[model samples]
Target: MRADPTRASSADASETDPSGDDRAHDAAVPIARSLEAILMVADEPQSLVSLATAVGAPTAAVRQAIESLVADFDGADGGTRRGFELREVGGGWRFYVREEFDPVVRDFVLTQNPTKLSQAALETLAVIAYKQPITRSSIAQIRAVNVDSVVRTLLGRGLVTESSTDSETGAITYETTELLLTHLGINSLDELPLISPLLSDGRGGFDDVA
Candidate 1:
């Protein structure tokens, strides 16, 4: 009477594969849905690696998912083309208001009462507008208050958006959007009033106002 070595080996292998069941469960998630969930809240374009990591999918699968999303949004799948488009910019993927729909979206955002921003959002937007590439921590420091929610509000309103991420600090730097300028009836940041004169002491400028 002898024990089966093959059965014992199979048991050992199964014991070592801690993630085998988890991986199978994760595979049940549709790649497109996973990508959509992550991209919806993503403030900036996500690289393939980042998207893959966030979705727990392989890079090739993520790339395919992005392509599928592009086609789906473009009406290639027999659906109406979306008002927004998924674009690859600066080596990453993000959603943008389609060029033809920008005016409509802008009008809706600026004129729609439901979209009105709060005082905190306005203040955070102003800081981003003047600073032109300030991080959340820096904005919080200038305002002397937590700006996380306010910044999210500005982003939701399309007044401010992430411009870049700090390589060393991994902080997201934000800036005013063209939609903000359109709402303000201005062509450029230069058209905004100078903060230096607005300060009573004119010593610390924006920091003093905040």
Candidate 2:
């Protein structure tokens, strides 16, 4: 009996497309939940292209998802408004604490987390350590959260110091102190892992840099 070409092609297609069924399943959940997860830990605003690349979605879909998220966070759909929000700055999207909640959040960080470094302080310190001589505003831009209180904490702890102030902008730049190196148990910033590799994009096009 001769082999049937039609049946042979069908079997080959199935073998090559074994996971075609899973594509829909994987894509179904990534737009909202995955974006939220990414934004939660993000250190800076992410552009639409970057976000789409991370979530494996088209830019259009990502835009729609962003709009939906904005509305959701704003309580437009009759849900409890979130204390934080997704905001666009420097041509990217990032999360920020609502203005009204800043005082309370700062108080909690200073009072409740007195013994240990709050996450905000740690993040700000890392920024200064890697991007030394960075302004407070620059640090805030990278973190997409206000760094004023966190900078004060690092200053009080002696982990970071004001290195210089911009002559043109008058923005004070910060640098890591010896105390921070001692705590880190490293000789220099070079010992710190490459910042690009740790970032989500691996290259973190940080030209705007706050």
Off by over 4 Å in 1: 1-29, 114-117, 135-141, 144-210
Which structure among the candidates has the greatest lDDT? Answer: 1
Listed in order, each prediction's TM-score against the native is: 0.60, 0.48
Model-by-model lDDT, in order? 0.78, 0.77
After TM-score superposition, what is the CA distance of residue 121 in candidate 2 from its true location, in Å?
Answer: 7.6
Off by over 4 Å in 2: 1-29, 116-210
Expressed as tens digits, the lDDT of each residue in 91-178 for candidate 2 is 7788888989867876775575569887778878888887788888878888888887788778666678767666655456789999
Model 1 lDDT tens row, 45-147 = 6888999998787898788778878888899957999888898875788887798986677567656647567788887787788876888888888788998
lDDT of 2 at 160: 83
Could you tell me the lDDT of residue 132 within candidate 2?
83
Model 1, residue 61: displacement in angstroms? 1.0
